[model samples]
Structure formats: C-alpha cells, structure tokens
Target: MFNSFLKLTSICFALLLLPISIMAQELPSSSLYVVTSCYVNEGSSFLDAVEEARATIPNDDNAANMMFFRQPIAGTNFEKNQFFRVVSWNNLQHWAQPRSLPATQEYSCDNHNRTFHTTRVVGTNGNTAYTDTDVAFVSARQCMAKDGVSLSEVYDWVDTRISRGQASRQNDNTMVQMSHKILGASPNVASGRMITIRRIGDSRQGYARFFDEQFMGTRDRTLGALPDAPFEFCTDANLTESYIVHSPGRGI
Candidate 1:
C-alpha cells in the first residue's frame, strides 16, 4: 500500500513538471485574462483559502503561470467584497480544452465573473510574473473617447506617456506596464481600456506610499506627465484597485 502511494505521488510530480518543461519559448502578440470575482463563504476564511491555494496551485507549470488577487475596495457592486483570479495564456487555441487541475489547490469561492484580453501596447515585459507574498497594486481603466476623438489619438497618448516615463527614470524602479483591452466580457469596452501594473510592497500602507510617489509625485518625475483624457470617442469609464495574492511565473 505504501508503494502504491509513493507511485501516485511520483506520477503527480512528473505530470506537473511536464507542462513547465514544454511551455512555449516565445510569447504571443496578446494574452487572455479571465478575471473571476467572488466573496468568501460566511464560515470560510479567505486567508485560509489563500494558504491552501498557495500549496496546491502549480504556478510554476504552464497552467500555474496565472495570478490571483483580492479586491478590497468597498462601496461597489452593492458593497459585497470580492477576490479575483486572473488566468493568462498566450495561446487561445488550447485554453478551452481539459487540463489537469493542480494537486494543491483545494478551495473555491462565490460570485460574478468577467474576462478580457489585452494586446501589448508598451513595456519592457508585456507579460506579468507575480510574487507569492508581495502584494502588487493594480489599477485598470476602461475608457472611451467622446465624439471627435480618433483611436490613433488615444493610442499615441498612452504610448507617449510610457515612453516619456521610461526616459526620465534613472533606474527602472518606477517602471509601469500598460496594455489596451482588446476583448472583454460586457460593459468592458475595447477602445480605450488601459491596465497599469506596479510592484508595490507587500502591505496596504506600502502600496499607498508607492502609489503616491508614482502618480502624485512632482509632475513628470516618477511616472511621465499625465495625459489629458480624450473625451471625444466615448465618455463611460471604470477604475478599480486590487491586491495581488499570488505571483505568476515568467511569461513564455
């Protein structure tokens, strides 16, 4: 009986390694992110669920190279708090097919789900690699220009801001990556949506300091000059902040 148990463990370990070893070397022009938001059950501890997921999620493997986060901001969606799971993959072709679940993640949550894909617009690395303990603060903006704004004008605005920031920084510490939303689940329009990622420290206070310095600092010093909002194409928008709960491995 012990021998059979050992065999099962070995097989599972090997299976986990297979995807990592076989992962593609090059990244695609775009990636898909499936964002799931849910509330923890009344009796279940969210932290406990995080601990179990850390043990079970095979983030080092192809399937594990995704991110999980918690959206602590309140007063939205009728004040129900939620967590998020972001799954990223280069190839859309194989995403729907059955894949083996990690032996470690033994948990679940409840809520509404939304998904979107982004096309790389500007950055040193268009993909994300998350850390286990460090909580990254992410700010995503979904926007559209008003009547007279052309798509190219909005594109130039973001592209120039990123380039200017990169040029001003003496080091890459203030680095920020931005992407344009290409496809999304309803109310998540594609035209002017932008997602910005910053590696703030592990705590909420730390994130606050970093956020201030990055966005509220002296004009064009940390992050480049803020671009004027183009209200010509469309006027609707949504912006939210979330904390990283899980880190993703390097993007292929």
Candidate 2:
C-alpha cells in the first residue's frame, strides 16, 4: 500500500477565512469530518472496529452524528447512538465473490487496517440530498515559496475563468486535469484516495487510485464516498447517485 495510515486524527489548524456562503454549511461548533476505515489482510468485524473507535473518540463528540457505507448507519432501527456508525467489509460481497468464500478467508492472524479521514464544513443536515465540490487552494506565489513555479498558478488562471463564469466550459475539464497534472508532479500528496466534499450536515465522497511503491497490483483503496460518515470499501450501492443528479456539477 502507498504508505497509507490506518487511523489519522485532525490537528487544530486555524481556519483560513472562507466565503460566508460556504462557511454557513460548516458543522456547528463541532469540527466535521470524513472518516475512512479499511481492513487489508482480513477485513475486521464492524463491532470490533467500533470498539476500537470508542477508545479513540472523546465522549462529547459522539452524540447525534451520521455514518454511511455498505448501508445506512443503522442496525434495522435508527435510535440511540445515531451519533456513530460501524460498517463491515460486506460492501462488494456480491461483486467480489463468485458463489463461495475466498480461499484467503481461511487464513488466520489477519491484520485489519482502519482509517478515519474528515474535513470540516458547515450547515448540512447530514443527509444525502446535498452536494458540492471541495477544493484545496494555495497561492501561485505561496506554493512556490520553496519549490518554485508550482502548478498552483493554474488555479489562479482557472479562478479567473470561473470569475468570468467559464467554470462550465466543456473544453476545459479544470479540476480533473489539475488532479492528474499535480499528481504527475508531486506524486506524494496524491497518496490519498478518497476525496470528500462536505456541506452542513452532509457531504459526498469518491475514491480514486493512488500510486504505491509497495504493491504488486494497483491497490483498490476506494472505500466508497460517504456523507459525514465512514467510507465503505465494499458495496453495490452508490447513494449519492440520487442526490447529485442535476449537473453539470463537480466535487472533490
């Protein structure tokens, strides 16, 4: 795997001023997040992972939140502890299996790797109905502070286009192309596979392949995108399909 961390926590970085419009969708006083958990050697049980999380999170932040993955964050009923979610690796069970268990499942001493990743945003109801694109920005000048003439200059050019309302121009697939170009150059920040977009109580997520020096095959790191919840690695469902229908839209 590409040096992927199992579980990561957010550091308290001061907020850079964002547009008030976008800021409005940000989670309340609490910092919003996109958490990803994965089990590499042998997938871990949902309950066990949840037990692991219980030891990691503070008590207050565990109240009234949402999680999504192979299914909704509920065990038949949405009741107490709507605040947390636990998803197993049953996500791609139908697609990944032929008709029987994989021969590998017989192997014991399997190591399960779980990851939690998130970004803070304002005001979404933590539902699937909301959608938006998230971008990480840096100044053409600042990005070159040491490396010199970084590709970030391209964003300023794109922003100029958007300011002129050309963000919709088909000939220019601004974001997608930029992702490829940047990864081609930096090759490191590109290690992250899940790109998440958050708004208020909800968010949209998608997984992409990232390069790793250690894997023989392309590691399929996509644990599907989720609303303010955990990413699901195996599932036949893509819930945001219903939510982001009317577009001419984009999000990270």
Candidate 3:
C-alpha cells in the first residue's frame, strides 16, 4: 500500500507540471514608440539640421531619424531646413502602431514674430499632400530597409535588464502600462515603482488592457481600476520576458 501511495504522488506531480509547460509556450513580446525633444536652430541650413539629428541619436543605427523638411511655395528662400523627427521601436506594440505619437506642428524662427504656417512638405511642385502616416511610414522603412541596425541590437539592450528572475501569480493588473513606456515602472504599476518581474518556468495566457506610465504591478479588482479592462495593450514574448499583451479593447 505504501509503495502504491508513492507512485500516486509521483503521478500527481507530473500532471501538475505538464500544464505549466504548455502555458510556458505562450510567452510574449511587442512594439512601442517614444517622443523626444530635439532643437533646430534659426537660419541653420538643411545639412545643419541633419547633422544635429545625427549628433543627438544615441547610436550608429541607421534607423535613427534625422527629421523632415517642409515649405509653402516650393520656393528655396528659408523653408528647406524646417522639419521634425519620429523614432520607432519593434515589439513595443503600443508605440509601433503608428498613431500613438503625434506629429510635430510647424513653428517659425526666421520671421521675428516667429510667424509659421500650417506648412506642408513640398515636392518639386510645392504641394502639401502628405499625411502624418505617410511621414511615419517613410521613417519606419528608412530605418529597417537600408544598412541600419537590426532589431536584435535593441533586443540585446533590453535583455540585459531582464536579469531579474522571480515567480509570482500572473498579475493582469500590472505590466500592461509598463509595456508602452519602459519596464519595471513600479510606482506607476504595483505599489508605485518599477521593478523587474521575477522568473517563471510556466506561462499563462490572459488579456492585458490599459497603459499609463503611472500604473504598475498587480492591482486588485476591489482596490484599483478594472483588472480585465476593455482593450489590448500589445503582444510578443521571449524566454526572459513576455512583452506582448492581448487586451480586448482595441485589436478585436
């Protein structure tokens, strides 16, 4: 009888471990975006603007943006150097979706009172026909298309931060918001401070919705906002961290 009891215990442990292994297969990853402040000087030439952007970009990655130029009459008086920038992040779903980052408005420095129009980019024909999405697409393709840095370079940087390894109940409450901005934002997430998630050998699938830099960690249904909020944050995963989220608000 004792021998039979031992065998039964072993069977139970295996059964429990099996589901965890299957869930582990569903880890995640995602894409995101960031808006940064860059300065353009008055009377600076177009080449000067490009050089300024090059200096500001952190790395040699060709994906780094240099900004865009625009003018009103398609004339070359003082319009060629006027432009702004947009950057991208792969697997940071909320940011990469294209609409999250707003485009820069035209401001003037050449005309003393800084008079600027709702200026648009001029082709050889001087037409303001470009949409915000058009500009975004140009920057996106520019970085990934040519001799630029690969997604792996960015991944390598993020992976180093994934050094923390602890296990906890999968909190639908936390992490969703962090995916948009940065990781381990605890003060905004759980208990209000960013911290790396612990290691987990098993995985579980669930929805993630809502993101605010201030929201972090696991929140309770009775204590905080809706746990199963009505949206999806973003989605993608890896052995170290599951960056993707499929909350049911937007991507139905």
Candidate 4:
C-alpha cells in the first residue's frame, strides 16, 4: 500500500509539470518584445542620442541581441518626455540572459520587471512585413479583472478579438497588424496587465483604425458574444501609446 502511494505521488508531480512544459512550448521564442520607458534630460533629442550611442555601446549580449527604440506618441497620462524601447528575440534561453544597455547621461529609463506571456501572431501581410515596418504603434494597457476570471480566459478573449479583427480587414496593408501578450510578473500598478502592439504604415490613422475596429466593435458585441464580455471583466483600464524606434538589420 505504501509503495502504491509513492507511485501515485510521483504521477501527480509529473502531471503538475506537464502543463508548465506545455506552456513553455506555447510561448514563441521568435516573438519576444521588451519595452522600457525612458525620460530624456531637458533639451535633448533623445532618439538621436540613443542612435549615436548604439555604435559605441559595449558588449551586453542580451541587449545587443534585440533592437532598440523610443515610443513618442502616448496618452495624457504619460509625460511628454516618456518613450519606450522595444527588442525582439528568438527562444526563451536568449531572453533569460541579463539584458543590458548603457544608461548614458542623456536620459534616464524605467524598465519593466517581468517576463512575457505567450505571443500570438494575429496576421501578417507578407512573411516579412512585421520586421519591415518603419514604426510600430504600441498600446500598453494595465488593469485588473473582477473576481473568478482566470488569466487564461483573458488571453482567450484577446485572441478571439485579434482573429476577428484580422479577418474583417481584407487588406492587411491598409490596416494595422495587431498582437498582444500578458506580462508574466504582476506589474506594480495592477493585478494583471497586457501590452497590445500594432505594426502599421501610419501612426495616426493606424491608431484610429484600431479603435474603430477593435475597441468599439468589441464593446458593441460583448453582451451578444459567445464567450461573453472580456473587456467588462476588467477595471481601471489605462491605455498609453508609443512609437517604434527602428533598428535596421537586427530584428528577427
């Protein structure tokens, strides 16, 4: 009887590990994006400074592995000096390394202390359109959900919205390409949060198109939808935007 109990305990342990392994497999290594907030010192072209330092920055394998940039357009909540630097990588192993970029005298930065949730490729115009785009309009929304709503459920709802939006648009080039992922660690401001990024041809128009297609439409259909209301489940939704800083010949 004791031997049988030991075998049962082993099986439970293996079962517990199975989901973790499966989740790791689901996370795309090639789809990593790291965003850091920056505040430039008074009277300086922050983008140009970072651009100049790019060449001289020393070997920080993790930082060097990905592209860097500043996000310019944002909501009123974010200050004018605020910007975001984004990076992409292949595989979780590379992401695990300590990423370092120089904090020059030109600017100060605030980094997110979290790992990325699974990345979903909403749709692509061509295989290379995502990388080829000049700028990306990233919408970062931080919020928490009502009681009993699981994180996986939230992801499922988001995935559905992305799929429907992608399908609605016949021309991928005309509209923005959208994708979203949750933050693995809880953000300081909220119980849960998500970053939604769209690689688009124009920031202003693309931003408008996203709202008309995704947010407004989702709001209208929530009650009638099969999976039920996703947006209504959350409170304190704060959205802010950023413009991508292009790093040529370096992204995946």
Once fitted onto the true fold, the runs of candidate 1 whose alpha carbons sit more than 4 angstroms away are 1-28, 58-64, 100-112, 119-133, 145-156, 169-175, 179-184, 188-210, 214-252
- Candidate 2: segments with Cα more than 4 A from true spot: 1-30, 37-61, 70-112, 121-252
Candidate 1 residue lDDT tens string, 1-252: 999999999999999999767642343255566566555555655676566665665544446335555555433452343566665565566355556655423345432446555534454323232333344454444344544554455545555666665555443332233444544544644444444333323344444554566567675642322357554233222223443444553322
Per-prediction TM-score to the true structure, in the order listed: 0.57, 0.21, 0.27, 0.57
Error of 1 at 123 (Å): 4.2
Residue 89 C-alpha lDDT in model 1:
60
Against the correct fold, how does model 2 do in TM-score?
Answer: 0.21
* Ranking of all candidate structures by their lDDT, best first: 4, 1, 3, 2
Worst 10 residues of 2 by lDDT: 135-144
lDDT of candidate 1? 0.49
Q: Candidate 3's error at 234, in angstroms?
A: 14
Q: Please give the lDDT score at residue 104 for candidate 4.
A: 75
lDDT of 2 by residue, 154-235 (tens): 3333234333322332222112111111111222333343232221111222211101111235434334333322222212
Better of 1 and 2 by lDDT: 1
Which wins on TM-score, candidate 2 or candidate 3?
Answer: 3
What shift in Å separates residue 44 of candidate 4 from its native position after superposition? Answer: 0.4
